[model samples]
Target: MIGILYFSSTGNSLYIAKKLKENLGGKIFYLPKYSGNGSEFEKIILVTPIYSFGMPKHVYDFLPKLDKSKELIVVQNYGGMVAGADYLMREYCTKNNLNLKSIYVVQMPENFTLSFSVPKFYLKKVLKKADSKILAVVDAIKNEKYNLPKKRKTKEKTYLKNMSNWYKIGKEFKTNENCVKCGKCIGLCPVGNISIVDEKIVFGDKCVACLGCYHRCPNKAIVYKNKKKKNRYINPNINENEIGQDI
Candidate 1:
């Protein structure tokens, strides 16, 4: 059995993972609420986006708890240069004693800050290409048509500084009076970081900085820094239905 484990906030990585599952066969598992050891799959495909030049704390914390005997393929989707994380997958396997199979990088449009604007046609082309490349990799893994990499040392950083900063800056979630206090923001948080308190939306420290809360709110209640631009791309998965639904 193959275990496709992933962590996605804005649905880019999740979209890729779902596409990979469509191309290949694997049971999908999310990397949240980690309990006990992982599944007994002989092959594991780990996918996530980089957070501040490193793996997110949720992924890093859960990696140590998983059984490392599986063949591992690491996929990191990033916006800009993924500095200092080239050895992340191999290093993770080394620490946990898993066989490191290969690494693939897919350059998706930036969803975090949205500083760069990706033309719609170009974005579609790139995602289609990524789908094909990831499908080929999935085939190789299924057939064992690859060699495992050597275990190497990884640099140790607690990742607390960046995470703390993100939480500090990102905890500014607010709901407009238009908010019926429906609690959509609380539900949209994948990490369970938000809650409705005294009929008002409250954000907690458990935020993973995925920003799903800001997008999925029904009444458009949630607001982060630069709240004016909040509703710009609430749903980043710009497929046909979303465009129609928003219109």
Candidate 2:
């Protein structure tokens, strides 16, 4: 059996995880503030985003809590035209004592709306193309019948330096008055780092910096620090049916 474990702030990773499930034949589990068991699978896929050159805090917390006996595959999505996330997975796999079977990295648009400012129409086009690539990888991984590029020698000091700086310059999510306080952010957070108190959203240190709260808000009530000038992405692939369901 296989288990699909993933954290998706804005559906790009989720879409990929769903497609992977179609190929791998597994039980699907989401990582948010609330989660469930994955004990039934012999194989598992860790799907998430490469936030600020590192793994999201939610994923790190959720992963350590998972049953590590299963063979692991990692898929990380990032903004297009950037680097891949294999090195991040290698470090995580090493720290967690899991044998990583394979690593797949993809570049999607940046999820933070106020950061990169990708146009909605253009983003939809990109998602359509990216979806095809994800499906191709699913086929390759399921067959266990392909060769991957040789692992490149990495600069550990550089990698750590980048990840450290990102964590240090952590993201802050602020909910605007427009927030209906519907508790969507609270439920969507894989690590239970957010809560709705007195009709407002509150955050805890457990935040993984996934930006799900910021982008997933229905009314665009959540904002990243100084993000007024940035562009946000709303998944064109999703609508009311799939919305508000943890990315």
Candidate 3:
């Protein structure tokens, strides 16, 4: 049996997990909501999106709990450099003695609206290319290719510095008059970092910086440092409701 475990904020990693399941035939589990250690599954595929060029803190915490004997495959979805995380995961498996089989990094559409411009017009072209890469990746997984991680030259030190700043990012979140108290962001946060305090949304300090709340805000009310970017992005291949289902 195969189990696909994934952590995604804006649907990119979830989309990749679904594509793998379509060909590989496995049950899917959202990592945040999942309880067990996955002992029943013989093969396990872990999918996650890169944050600060590495794994999300929630995903990193969940890694040690997985069944060590199971053959492990890692699929990382990224919108930018993956070097820090590629080395991090490989090193983690080596140190922990997990049955690490393969690792793949797939480029995804950017969802971090507060920091970068995610142009809607370019999504189609980007998705097309990503789909092609996903197909190739699925084929490789099925063939037992066992493609491993390679050291790619990147600013890993910069990534670490950025990660340190991510902890304080939620402190910058504030809503504008456009907020309707709809509570959508309350459900979208994987870390439960957003809440309604006296009928108004308030951000907590546990933000993992996935940007799901920022991008999926219906009214464009949620912003970092009182600035909402003109464009927000959710994966074109998946809907916001589906992404929120994990919550």
C-alpha lDDT (0 to 100) for residue 153 of candidate 2 = 50
TM-score of 1: 0.79
Off by over 4 Å in 3: 152-161, 244-247
Model 1 clashing residue pairs (backbone): none
| Candidate 1: segments with Cα more than 4 A from true spot | 33-36, 114-122, 143-160, 230-247
For candidate 3, what is the TM-score?
0.92
Greater-TM-score candidate between 2 and 3 = 3
Return whichever of 1 and 3 wins on TM-score. 3
- Per-candidate Cα RMSD to the true structure, in Å, reads 4.9, 3.6, 2.1
Whole-model lDDT for model 3 versus the true structure?
0.80
TM-score: the better of candidates 1 and 2? 1
Better of 1 and 3 by lDDT: 3
Model 1 lowest lDDT segment of ten? 238-247
TM-score per model over all chains: 0.79, 0.78, 0.92
Q: How many residue pairs clash in each candidate?
A: 0, 11, 0
* Candidate order, TM-score descending: 3, 1, 2
